[model samples]
Target: MDYSHVRGVDPAVADALEGEVDRQQNTLAMIASENHVSEAVMQAQGSALTNKYAEGYPGERYYAGCEFANDVELLAIDRAKELWGAEHVNVQPHSGTQANMGVYLAMLDPGDKILSLELSHGGHLSHGHPANFTGKTYDVEQYEVDPETGYIDYETLAEQAEAFDPDIVVSGYSAYPRAVDWERIQDVAESVDAYHLADIAHITGLVAAGVHPSPVGVADFVTGSTHKTIRAGRGGIIMCGEEHAKAIDNAVFPGAQGGPLMHNVAGKAVGFNEALQPEFTEYAERTVANARALADTFSQHGLEVVSGGTDNHLVLVDLRPSHPDTTGKDVEEALEEAGIVLNANTVPGETRSAFNPSGIRAGTPALTTRGFDEEATREVGELIVRIVDDYDDQETIDAVAEDVQALCDAHPLYD
Candidate 1:
């Protein structure tokens, strides 16, 4: 078979790769869940470690030639424990979903009740989505944020926890804008005698950088992605209290699947090391500042920001009032035409389908990492607002997109 065309390694593919790089270099990426990994992390991911496949934990590899691989993996685990203040760490899961699954398989029995935040109110599908393993394997109960305030209603959640009597209480969110009340969640989990699992996938970097409160002391288990604000390779991590260390390790390894991605683990170690640097703290802090600046700009332009505003790296903008008949899809398309990249998210109480949501989700982590600040964020925010407000004006939108490209050029990624 002539597999040359399928492999995408020829001239056409090379052009495509360059085009994608150009796109990233030119566009303002505001997806809250995405980030730009560092050169060191990238180097580690593409290193010689990719050749090895040690099918078990460090120092117990099935393969004979894994001495160096063991060292890298063990270093990643140790750094993760120190960074998050966990008694033990597992840096092997392929993704955030897999990390959560490992925890469930380790502790909970089939049909045991698991309480988590409602998906629409800012929770990951892996927490309890009906189509996910979490919902299929367990008796799932959900708590939601206040519809009006867009913040978690702690009192309401406490009442639900009291009523459901779940075996595990999950604390985490995908689109939440405000800080989580970890103390309250810990108290509730303690009262119910439920194990508390905090999935700090979105805020782990902030927590590590001290911009957000650490969930380590509050939750019995904490899981996070090495990506997002951490700016590492795409992988999951499980950090646990001493009591659950053995169970957590068993769940991640023999309980879940076999083998770990040695390459990604190496990248994770580099990212963890980078995160400990003074510059990374400044980067994380700037991410928060940029988010707030963008949110303030939106409010000034009369766009209704979900939860009123943000204290972190992302903001969910409610577009219902500004463009009554318009969907987030329309605004997203308009902005894309203007070279501004972001996701259309479903706001709480959204009547629209997930495919065409009523809200636009924007963040500043990528931009801040690219050296953007308050002024750049404000300019970007105004451009976003203008496009959404006058979505029908193609010429104006394109003109503003020109401005966006200019700004992106001034502050290039990984420069």
Candidate 2:
């Protein structure tokens, strides 16, 4: 993590980079979409490949001297195919949103209909939020989780799909904690003769480790970020059946992006190789177990754990039932001050604005990556509850900060 070269060039940027490394070492990162990549992956990402410009897929690159870039990209594609059992894989697209964009460009026209989960109820902005390009290009409708149970209402979704008659139906989520029924969603999509795009950006590693169900063979298109649950560097991937391979590739390259980030592709290669080992399975299982423990602790302490508990790496807590006066932002800031990091998230049937939502979302991926177990996660959950109970109490926050630093010390991150 030394920044000596950067310091020699520019002291200001070097200081910031060094400070960031120190911050990660000292705090707990509970953000659902974040994880610590292995040193191998990080080094690969920071490699000299960043200087290259390989404009196309492996062997068919438009530029000369792309031999090593071709090798790295091919290795990444092959590893991803093996990991997800997909017939075809595209390791281009700068991000998960771009991956989705690739799909829409390939299969949809402007003003085509899109059916997806509501953002507040566990959907992503790329699916169809008005602020994003997808919303501007497509005519969109949304489904939601059951108000009482806090779970996706499949029946309602089917009904919505029937009425909307969308050209595509999206199946994955960001904030929801329960397992998705991909086949059921596929059935609805099929009934309407619509394409199904499953975005597993948040659970790519979990699916690779067989901890979560995969949508590779079931959905018409599968898209994800290489980073979140996976230790891959920051990039996106798209997978589909062999029939649509050419279209996806062209859409990603000529349609959406120019040159692929070969350094990131190299990182994905290293991380995918790491994930292929048996230990990754244990890590995935422990991650889910830790989240369950966290959810149980929150519930036992009287917080309204959304959907009762979690089957994945995150737990969504609705603050209205237990602490109506407290906002998610309040808890979020207090926890950050206490060295615990998570996000203020909108919940199902949200009553507050998106900026100051009524729920908090926390996950165990980064913590689990740091060697945390169920017991350790439970302690972290207890500390979260303490902040939620008395966010304005500086003394309690100071005490929690001490305990959090001790936890960080016990489970050191980098060298």
Candidate 3:
């Protein structure tokens, strides 16, 4: 059962896998949409179903011998529906971006207008980034938060929606610290007769746990990754209201992608079942608690967190004041040397480019799942502050690596 051990694979790939596992166990993972899956989820993903070529949806496969695959897909769909109260669930999209694409393909025509959050303001690239297919194919109108408050301005969003009269209004984010107002988005979309798509990929687990409001009941379509806070296999799912159910399913199968990964679907089923447990609600609460703990630490160190602080699992640290001369990229590399994993992000309408940004983003969902509580988050935050402050010194970086290892060792993964 020691699947984490990497003793008998191709040396190059094995070495890389082992190295990744070692890095994970030694460092702290704070990426907002990332987490370590349970051993059971992992096992399910790597199961024999991967070898089977079950093209198309469950029973109506292009190929034969898909009886078991049908059961797996049904389980994933049923469990996800039960957990999130979705009328229809599609467990076929390979990733969140793909899931969103499926929804777009199902509902909109080419050149149709899509109103979404600006990418720099915590929105995903798939939403409307110029270089992405969505931007190239559809007319994009983006909205952002108030520059001073660092929160979405519903009035501005409504104005933009009216001006654009978009076919779809996207409501979601990747790096935003607070909860989005789904009702406001729904109202705006309704006023314009646009479909409301809630990309609740980051906070899906919280929504399922009732810690955050579920957009399933209000939004026309909802897309989420099963792996992030849900702690499932690496895949995406799209949930929607009853009216769009059949269209969404057909779009995912015959339109966008051909086959569903049955094994990953099985893993998703397990993850959804786990989320349905009472303990998952407790875990979600701890995730928020840990985020707050880290946010306090960042504030103590004089780093400005966007929206004052986080209302969820991720916190966006504005390192502008902390290191006026340094960039977010510089701080990110320095922190990586100290065995802390995070991403550099851009504030809304930021002057910096994507390669090197002005902000650092971290989260608590992964660490909290590893059994890290408020005290541990504080320690990790202290490490982050120390690394950022002493980034210029090689000796300090080395010392912090030792500290990171010590903390990681204290909570060894899967041991």
- Best by lDDT, which number? 2
Which candidate, 2 or 3, would have the higher lDDT against the true structure? 2
Error of 1 at 7 (Å): 10
Task: Please report how far candidate 3 places residue 168 from its true position, in Å.
Answer: 0.3
Ranking by lDDT: 2, 1, 3
Please give, for residues 1-415, the per-residue lDDT of candidate 1 as tens digits: 1334434657677667667778888888888988888878987997898899888887777889999999999889888877778788989999999999999999999999999988877899999989899999999999888889899988888889999999999998899999988899999999899999999999989998889988897899899999999988779999887888889888988789787889999999999988878898999999999999999999999999998999889999888977778889998988888999898888888888988999989989899988998998999998998898888898889889899989988998845
> Residues 147-264, candidate 2, lDDT per residue (tens digit)?
7888988888999999999999998999999998899999999999999999999999999999999888999999999999987978899999999999999999899999999999
Q: Candidate 1 lDDT (Cα, whole model)? A: 0.89
lDDT of each: 0.89, 0.95, 0.88
Model 3: lDDT equals 0.88
Following a full C-alpha superposition, what root-mean-square deviation does model 3 have from the true structure? Answer: 1.5
lDDT, residue 407, model 1: 94
RMSD (Å) of each candidate, 1 decimal: 2.8, 0.6, 1.5
